[model samples]
Target: MAEMKSGYIDYKGFKTYYEIYGERKDNGKKPLLILHGGPGDTHLYLLNYRDMADLYDRQIIFYDQIGCGKSNIPHQEDDFYDYDLWINEFFTVRDALGLDDFHLFGNSWGGMLATMCMLRDDTGVASMVVNGSPYNCQTWLSEANRLILYLPEEMQKAIAEAEAAGGDYSTPEREAAYMEYYRRHVVGCDPWPDFVQEAFKPENVGECFNVMQGASEFVMTGKMKDFNVLDQVKNLKVPTMLLSGTNDEATPFLIKEAYDAMPAGTEWVLVQGAAHIGNATHAKEYFEAVENFIERHE
Candidate 1:
């Protein structure tokens, strides 16, 4: 087992939890910082990635963004969750940890946050890997809703009706229909791993997701609906590798859209037979591509 270190950093007035999964050394293998999605998924979902630290020379860092798992919930009533708040929170963690140089890996919304970091400043990021992430919120909405159109008609009606109703989307009918999409595009696993299940717990996605991503997968009515990083992605100088599953909710098309705007020489990999959480279902391919990208940059 890699040496584990856990602690908290101050974010506003709350404590943000973080962990490092390896003993730091002066080795050229810089640490890998992972960002989990949800504006709200906890670091628990991505703990399987500790292997990068345990097996390889790299250390793996995991942190729950404010209002996320293992961290104090930010003020929901005050509308505290937004892209700027999230991006700022990330820097606070990085600086507090003194990670002057590192590799970055993010999944789903986490991947979006990685891009936000590079957009703000690429100073300490050595390389970055984004899986099932979106470069533009509008494109993310279009692609996911497009995938929804292909679901069974019953599901289509349930989602459309529920979204149109714009009330509680967790109703039995709405949730039942969305589960179909979740199975097909989110986990792509018959029985989800315990970690994945934990991350999807209702409590795991709280006010942050409510304020940033809204209540349903079919639409993005939250503040992030206008978030788009593609225009600025073209100027990023860091080595970037974009990954997406062929069956992903992020959609191969949207991944390619982001890839196209990325700086020249950016890497793109599409895992076959995988979906949103490709790392869970297609670990070999998903991680090999990431390992290769990080090695090249190192």
Candidate 2:
């Protein structure tokens, strides 16, 4: 154990819990603020990166969003569940921790949030990295739905039948089928590790995920339905690295559009053998890419 420290910061009438890893040195190692995926997911899966705090001689800040994981979970009030609220909380965390300028890396939904944060303000980010992120919600829905169609006919039918029956997303058979889709697209290379499997279990918070990102990958009924940052990438104003795997659910087509839209100084790299979670799927290659990018910028 590296003797991690935990604390709570008050944000928007609620308390958000976060953990700090590795000791800060006088050499000015900027903290890496990590935003985990799943609007409702905790930071448990991202704990894998704690070593990066020491490896890169940097600090890693991992926090559970309001109403998820070890964070405060309230009921009967979904008004505070929007993405903007999360961004506000992120700023609060940054200011409270005195993170003047730092590195930012996020995956999946986390990646989307990181971009949002960067767009809002670059005062606290020295560099930005977006991994396996979607540029447009509509395009994501189209691609994800297409992927769903590639599922076994029987499994797809089972899911349709289950949904037709009612809101039975909790059914054992439906869960199994969903896991199959997740394995193929979410993790890419089959047989996800145990920590990834653990994340599959239902956390069952408010419908934050559904309200902010829809019920599944194939649907876009959330507030992000019209979200598109393609035109704004040129305004990034920060050194940015757009990374993705060939087989990612994000797909190279989407990532290429995003990269082309970025400012001229922005850079990109593709991980060959990995999928959406390329950082975890191809650790050495991924880390090297990250290290090289940071060295160039730093």
TM-score winner among the candidates? Answer: 1
**Residue pairs with backbone overlap in model 2:** none
Q: List the candidate 1 regions with Cα displacement exceeding 4 Å.
A: 167-172
Give me the runs in candidate 2 sitting further than 4 Å from their true place: 162-167, 170-173, 189-191, 204-206
lDDT of 1 by residue, 1-298 (tens): 8889899998888888999998777878888999988877788877778877766777889999888788857456635667788789889988999988899999989988988888889889999998889988898889888998888898888898888888355678778778888889998886888888988787775567767888777678888889888888998888989988888999888988999999899989888889898767887787678888898888
CA RMSD per model (angstroms): 1.6, 2.4
50 in model 2: Cα distance from truth in Å? 1.1
What are the TM-scores, per candidate, against the unseen true structure?
0.95, 0.89
Against the unseen true structure, what C-alpha lDDT does each candidate score?
0.84, 0.75
Clashes of 2: 0
After the best TM-score superposition of candidate 2, give how far the Cα of residue 196 lies from its true spot, in angstroms: 2.7
Model 2, range 235-271, lDDT digits (tens) per residue? 8877889888876788778788788888888888888
